[model samples]
Target: MAHIETPTDEEDITDPVEAKKVLRKVDWRIIPLLQFLYMLTFLDRVNIGNARLWNLERDLKMSGYDYNVVVLIFYVPYIILELPSNYFFNRIEPRKFMGVIVMGWGLTVTFSGFSTSFGGLLVGRIFIGIFEAGMFPGCMYLISGWYRRHELVTRMAFFFVANDIAGTISGLLGAGLGSLDGARGYSGWRWIFFIEGAVTCIAAVLAWFYVPPFPENSNFLTPAEKKWLLNRLKSDNKGMSHEKMTIRKVADSLKDWKVLTSGVLYLAVCTTAYAISVFQPTILRTFGWDDLKSNLLSAPPRLASGIVSVLIGIWSDRIQRRGVFCLGGFSLSMLGLFLIAFLKGSLRYMGIYFAAIGIYIVQPLCIAWCANQVTSSAKRGTITAFAGTLGQFGGIISALVFPSKDGPQYLPGIMTCVAFQIAGVIAAINLWVCLSYENRQREAGKRDHLRELSQEEQDQLGEKHPDFRYTV
Candidate 1:
């Protein structure tokens, strides 16, 4: 039902400068607003991790294993509804559809503030996951509609930085709000959910008017500008087709191995990334710090994650490489995972937390890198959503694996993260090798159908036009 306007058969033409000129004609007003909305989307999901050490555990009377269980409840519906939600996202206007989703999850998050028992917490989180799952992939699809192929990495990087900024803001906000314990009798953890969720609700209300539906719908651009934008897209790949069904859309999508590969690597990244986000506060407590201090100190490592994620994303776009950056990121994370697995004393444990910070920087790079490799707009949307939705399974597993009893070192969780990092590295390498082989075949005039380009695409990429190169 989602209709993204792509170029029609009659509009297929080839002039690079004219295409670029056409792109300039479209409006730009809504871009900043959409980016901010997603930053809040990502931030709200992870802030529960920040609340772990504050008052969440005590209020729930969580046993040795309850922490991970709480997070696992979130992934159940989150995984099931991703593709369907995205398909609808394309059909409905983002201004309305994404606005509804944001508000739905914001209310769920706010309701969590009132939960007195773990059962109530699980119910709130499940709905949060269900609604929030619509955000990122829909945005990726939206971005593809706005920017051309060559311009994607930089734009994706800019959009992704909001996710990192949310992490930083979570820390800063956690520090200020954690001070609210016993203020008007509300606990520190409850305050976190209440305030952040309220902000999300307000942002959701605003998004209804702020997010542009498509080029044609954008009042910021003249009618001439909308046609120009449509033509630019036609040049890329026969433009948009919204008549596709969700099942057929997915079936067509599976023909590309990039989806499977990206999903696996993202799964691994999620493993290591969630380990840090979900457990870092608990890890901090292993040091000599008490509850408040542990919560306060946890902020720095996440802040460090924010700083490093932007630096790496910018560096990646500049260098235009994927495998090496992705591998290096997993390597840093693996080192951090192992350090915690093997070491023990408080000071030594603090050092392990720093390694955790360094590891998280790799995730956004891998996502941006993988996103660049996928071409078709609809296919790209499915893959991005699939990758993220599947990756959260790591969150589900960790909820059961790391208990309060495993605290102080959480050796098993550390080992699992390290092992998954190795898996992530292999997935990245495989992606590089497969794409490299295809790149070579195109050079040799032997473009086969085994994940190689079809003849129509071969012609477009044959010249290796400055506009056409693999995302890596």
Candidate 2:
């Protein structure tokens, strides 16, 4: 093992005021660009739901389960590519790599507008998935590198607020663009793809210029600020931040029980979220709302979800507890799903608000919770990507559950989401108990036997180091 030197106390930011200033500076520089990039990413991915309202299925001659297949195919490459993409993110300049991938997806989305057949659209979706695989997990990995563990959820909440905002924007844009039904001979659905995709390409150019490198190499930060930030992170992570990427580190992250459980937690939230993002318009239509009205109505639930997510993030970070918030959020989502499945009329529609808020809240909390447990940058990236890969299964499941045949109540799909939320609640409770127990054991010096190991071996222990405590 290669040992890295730890930052001295002299390099640490001891003054609370100065520390806050540095954090705020980092927040403004990185978070907004990440928010914009991710927002566009989400808008491009889920706008297809909106497009369905504008006759995409009819225009392309899609029938039966063809639309579902289009949704399902995107996740195949998406799930397969995430781990490798994160692996490459570690080895490449993040801005350059992210810029390239964003451009790739943007172009795919733009050209997808021109598709004349189901096969053409399917091919476009696959390419979009391939290009977009790295984005969310990559953002999570980058955010973890910049902020302390306790500060993480709030920042990630803001990041995911972009996701909710994108959901809102997708609905609004769909309504706005769908009205263009024919402009220069293109249908309103094509306009959605063309306009959004073009904007993404433009954003991609800006991303190449603005997205900051990791703290260690960030040019925007003064050397003193960099030193302080690095020292703070090193102390927070017990010097585990100094570890290099290695095969063993990767393998260790893959096998970690905590990482796997976190994935289950994430999966439950994502399953419901993905279902709503892709099918909310259709679901609303079943409630007797016209297509445009359905598109317009979808905005409020997502907007409400964004607000609740930010509030929960602030509260979770202040309390510095992850599991309790996750449990609350998951329970709220289950309640919403239950209402949506069982109720009728306006009551059923109101359930969407609860589901949206709950799912969005749990999504970021689970991501930050998972990232909080791992100390090594390499392992953090790998584990975040791994957990994220598992979560994408929700997208696949979402596609299958809400088939057109099941619409006008979609009881089976709604119930399926409810089941996953219950699973999420259980997973969250189990992880909390396990992590809290390990933390107590570490505090009691039960892991002190490892102190006799060589310096390199001790460093290699990463989160398992006796002095390291997990955030539950």
Candidate 3:
């Protein structure tokens, strides 16, 4: 068992100065390393869309549906492996597990560069999805372990900014790599894979040594610091127990209605996010811009979204609220997508900026919102994976909606995103209602049965414990 040292007083344990010091250390040590890893993951996943502008489909003799099929295949392995990988992530030391995942995906991405036919590229994408299955969910689980619920959104935002940066830089990188066209007899698209994958591979090797595990086992902290950190989190919720995860626990965690609702909410958002990330470059090219100019134009919208994500995260944490921010973000996405679906020319270009801002900001908030509601470590892992696994189907939805048949307008795809954005808003409101009602019930002493249970039993009950109040 890990050592647990109790401070003589709660005030000493939560001293503002000491808490700030630890927060800064964790932000610097933990967040930066994970940020780099997630950025690489996003780069490899969405760069296929970037490849399209450079004649990747024509070079490989791929039909329009064939391209969609290739994109679709990635989600198969990604969804199937997410839950099991997260389960194992908690069982194994995170450094080894996450390192192996990063390296596996990096290798697969590099191999994708060597594909001579559509079949080879298909196989590479499948493996890339499998290897990447655990990264985002695992990162969420890991971040939850370090920070309290109120402090979580900002940290998650910092981590999520990597996704926006990846989207923005994919454009810049795709443009620069275009210069490498015909070098070593490979197209610019191939060099995008080769160079980015090589860098990911190097970063993965370093992550094994750098990425810290749960706070209790972290090597960078002193023994007293580790105990203090653990105690501080435990006081926030008793369900953060050291007990080993079990099959029953995993099943029970999945049975929560909130998990399903959260999954649906995220599913609605993911379609919009993946669509924007994967196809925004192609969308820009339709405006009479050449390959380089389209890629350059793609950067600003995502850059705006990234900057706003940090600000929203800080605001969410400051006010200790999440659902309203999510609702507002999705509303922005709805307006943006509606504009894109109906408008043309310069006005439509303005829609892209609005859509970009709305699409990217909601995702991190949703993840952080879900993370705050769960109490147990194992349950947190399970729900994050469950939500992620369900949300990944949105990628498939995106692939199917935007066939090349739609061309420059892509009205069906754009409207599909608009409809989902409305659904996401509704789901956010519903979650807020249910959570608030539950908190009221707890305040009214409706969970008196919790008083009869021992500490271990109360811990096992997780969010069901009477003292546990859901974050709205």
Candidate 4:
């Protein structure tokens, strides 16, 4: 495999104006396409929640616990395939690999509408899980490759905003399509699957043309701009090394304490996020709103959360701090969970907005934070995928927590989410303290003995190099 070589002759882009201009150009070309792809991915994944609102369970003859079983089935392959899919993603051309997976899931989603029984739906979800597994982590890895550490959280936040957009659109689309329940003799929920899936298929086709390759292979930038971008990223990690995917690197990533801790944080956040995406409409319906109103009302919280995410991304980047922001976000989420679990009427509804904002805020930040601490491409990709795989367990937990028997105010489910949020807070604090201690040790020259190693050995050390400081 080829590596991105930094040009020896090229100087850094010293002018702030030119730097901003180059970054803006890159952002416009890539961010929108990435956002669109992720939006579709999310839309297809969670629209099942909206589908339930339109008599999908009744029409398919699903009985007690059957609906949750279908939801749980999607996460099985999704979690299992994440590591290998991302491994191939690291090895393959970005455009080809991403396009194929998007198309695969899109077709699966479309055909999913044809299911006549719970077993059929279950099968379709498994395939969807397999295909969709690579997307979010792959995108995070790709974004990390493009931007420097300080610029990363904001870009990732913008990318993650796609989730909020998809959630909002899913709600609106569910209501609009639900109105077409009898059109062409197909149920409205079926139309949701058919139409959204078809759009994703089309987007997948466009991805082949529009998706930017990794920086080394990208043709859209000038030679100078590309060199500057690559060099900028190189400087961000000082002793960082580029390496091909290898089994050892994968094992190293799995063994890293930082990776394990980050995965635990992500798992906590994902548990809350998956629960909300899959059950928000149902929870809202329990608030005395009819199906249409439940779907419609779901949109606002997502929109509000999207705005908050972008703002926090900018602030987090400005301060160049991740852990503190994450702690604050977790606090907000816990507050929201408390209100929803214990309060009544509109106050409980207000909890949705709080939970949405905090969860969305923490999620992208956590990914960015993890990526920030890793300096090797291979290790970074593996770490991202491994953490994401652990996070998907949250989807399984979500499926089990909100049984149909626990409606109106699913106290048990809401409280479970609250517990996860508190766990996230503790994890964040532990990671922050540990990294801060490590950084202080490096400053005190405790790691100076490793500086005697050869340059090649030092480079291979990646984040463990004496000069390579951990981001707190």
Candidate 5:
């Protein structure tokens, strides 16, 4: 394949595909800061789980399904605002938008620690929802803006590791902090909220200072390095040039069946993922361990999930295939669910925790895959947000299953999660098979349109060749 060099503004670039490749290059200097920013995002979002293990509800006198209700409140404004949040991310400056989100959520996380009543906690969680809601999709939008579709899976896994790894940290911290339940007149669960929430505010301060804007607007990159970046993207075909998307454009981008399928696939994974995220520590409590031990035990499964995520990401990239990883990983996650569902308390089933690792794989890979599937870069960003937001609808449903009264044994919730993981696997297979068949047909020289037609006859083909991808 012939590559096109990045053209200067002074020149007219030929081969739009080659020009597009020039736009996908990443700035290495900024990635580490972004990773930490995402780390903070995950930490603040999942710390509520740690609070659960620390006996937060019991301390506050939350009963019945009240705990679940508190957790569910965060997702309300979160899901409702995602589309506009992402649109704001792209339209406004990401560095500014993202920093504000980080700082705002940090405040909410801190206030959550001081809530003395259900109404107060409800208010805190709602603030958390409003603040943290835009941070993720905004950050993801920033990431895809910086890197090309192909280079993103492993990187997204690294970024998402922040979530699982944050889970581990929350577990470890929750355990240690619960040991301080009676210290300084503060309950251990309250301290967990106080400490973690405060840390997020501090991290938000750091994000304000460190998280840079899009590369084209970056100060760190030399003029020459920026040129190198542009040229490199011109070598990949996914456009990253200066272009903005309009509302009508976003709607038009949804015309493909692939968009609908990708949304469903991700929703399935989110159902299981969110189910486990908020409830994992509580689930471990059923093993007859007390608050501290249960919180500590929650760390291992998350660490296991993080470790396997990196390996699966590398393997998925190495194999140069996205769909295989999505299907295989979800299958393993489902298997883990089955083991936990049936074996209950057996040593033979201990590996169920390790199998949870597979669930982590689909998130990063499938996210990267779907973002790559669309042709228009602006359209791609909106689709990514749409898929993520739609997927979060699972959170609403998953939260309803883990009742506080079901304590010491939440089998119904775990089984519910298992069913969703299987559903994701099936959806992934549907997408994989569809894309594979499309590729084969193109290889066989079947144009779908009449081959005998003149170039002008197939107007809708626009510049898109069959090489266009689908998210597995």
Candidate 6:
């Protein structure tokens, strides 16, 4: 056996076989754990809604306003802490940082089972919001460190499908847990938190080993493989990896136009996604079904969403156009909302499938799209975190929009979502125009250059490198 020399940018290996081999290893060792953790994370977050169907509000004597308030409180810390949490993840040990946060949230959910009053549930939700805030942005930052810009949307789709899968199964799990209402002197809803929370804790323990840190710090990769991986990424993105967090880098990320516009786009889409996540069960119940039946039927739309997200991701990757799909996906979402809003009977019910597809599928693309614009490792963390933080504002709007008075048709909420979906479409168009103009500028600058910079210099310049192009 011979050691392969560390590749320079000019000599970077882009062999399909080698790329596939490494990707497969990463998929096997990394993606599954992240997916599972996210599944649990999502399951914990939404199961409270299911618990409401099982008399959660009644059990605690929670007024409609109180219930909404409790739900709203969670997003407070979720919005405030996201950027700082992600920064901590970037600076700290991934396994420990991620594992502790996972465990912390799981414990929070577990204690939620014991809540005897509205105040208790509020306490549980607040802490759950605090710890779970880090999960998506942190995991995303980690995934970006591994894949090239073109490859990111698919990987993000793979990872985000967990939310859809969790949505699909969380209903079934809730229904099944409902059967345990009297089990061991605990209510079924209580059992849901206890059992799901415990599973999350177990996943956290496994994550400590399975969720390897940055590739450079991984124990699994050989020196040759690390060199090849880093160089290939460097060739695709000059500042893809090998950077530490610093104050100047953080400030630069905040000042970037791409970061501001991308965050706005993400916030728009997230408003739609968060609304769907919380209200789907209640919305499905309007189809004249019982609780169990509503839970069961809700599964199909999410399953469709999971399937559509992956397929759309593959298509987006192949086309190498993120903003186009974002625009298309959000446009589809608006149509779905219109169908659900104005149509009657089965047609409106059918709209769930379209709505689910539109909302869930666009999520991965939004995250990947913002991430692709920032090439520096530290800036990636800051921008992704900032975008995620802003998106939490959508969650706040989602909570308030679906007031209890708007039962069955819920026209106001539906219309509000339609409006936001339209906003999301507009945001997508803006992102496309911005990226297109910037990429043209970069291309033009390259043509006017007097001399080519060395690979090292280009790598140091990152997304600002004259040869680097943004993924639109």
* Highest TM-score scorer: 4
lDDT digits (tens) for residues 1-472 of candidate 1 = 4543444435543455545544544324545676788888877777787777577889888765566777878888888887787788867988899889999999998889999988888889889989988887788777766755545555665676575567657766776786797799988888999999999999998888778776546665545556667666556533233333366867767667787777788788777666666666677777777766665666666666666666666676677676777777777766766767777675456555555555556666666666666555567677777787778787776666677778677888778777777888888888888777766766665543423656565544322432334655
Residues 333-420 of candidate 6 have per-residue lDDT tens digits of 8788888888878898788788879877788898888888877788888877888888888878888888878887778888887887
Q: Which is superior by lDDT, 3 or 5?
A: 3
C-alpha local distance difference test of each model: 0.70, 0.89, 0.85, 0.89, 0.72, 0.82
Report how far residue 350 has shifted in candidate 3, in Å.
1.7
TM-score of every candidate? 0.84, 0.96, 0.95, 0.96, 0.88, 0.93
How large is the C-alpha RMSD of every model relative to the true structure?
6.1, 4.7, 3.9, 4.1, 4.9, 3.4
TM-score of 5: 0.88
| lDDT value, residue 342 of candidate 3 | 79
lDDT of 3 by residue, 1-472 (tens): 5544434442344555666676688789999999999999999999998887676777788885988988889999999999888788888888899899999999999879888889989999999999999998888888988888888889988898998899899999989986688898888889888988999999988788888888878888766567778888888874766555677888987888777776888798889889988888888888888999989888888899999989999999999999888988898888888777778888888898888788677888888788788787877887788889988999999999998789789999988888788888888898999999988988988888788988777767777788888888
Q: After best superposition, candidate 5 residue 420: deviation in angstroms?
A: 1.7
Assess the local accuracy of residue 290 in candidate 4 as a C-alpha lDDT between 0 and 100.
94
Ranking by TM-score: 4, 2, 3, 6, 5, 1
lDDT of 2 by residue, 224-320 (tens): 7788888888888874664456767778778888878878987898899999999999999999889989999999999999998999999999999
The TM-score measured for candidate 4 stands at 0.96
lDDT by residue (tens digit), candidate 4, 1-472: 4543433335556666677787898999888899999999899999999999987998899999999999999999999999888789888888899899999999999999988888999999999999999998888878888888888889988998999999999999999988899899889889999999999999998887888888888898777788888888898897766777788879978888888887888899999998889899999998888999999999999999999999999999999899999998998988898889889899998999999999999998998898898898888888788889999998999899999899878988888888888888888898899999999999999999998999888877788887888878
Which candidate leads the pack in lDDT?
A: 2
Residue 153, candidate 3: Cα error in Å is: 0.7
| Poorest lDDT segment (10 consecutive residues) of candidate 6 | 3-12
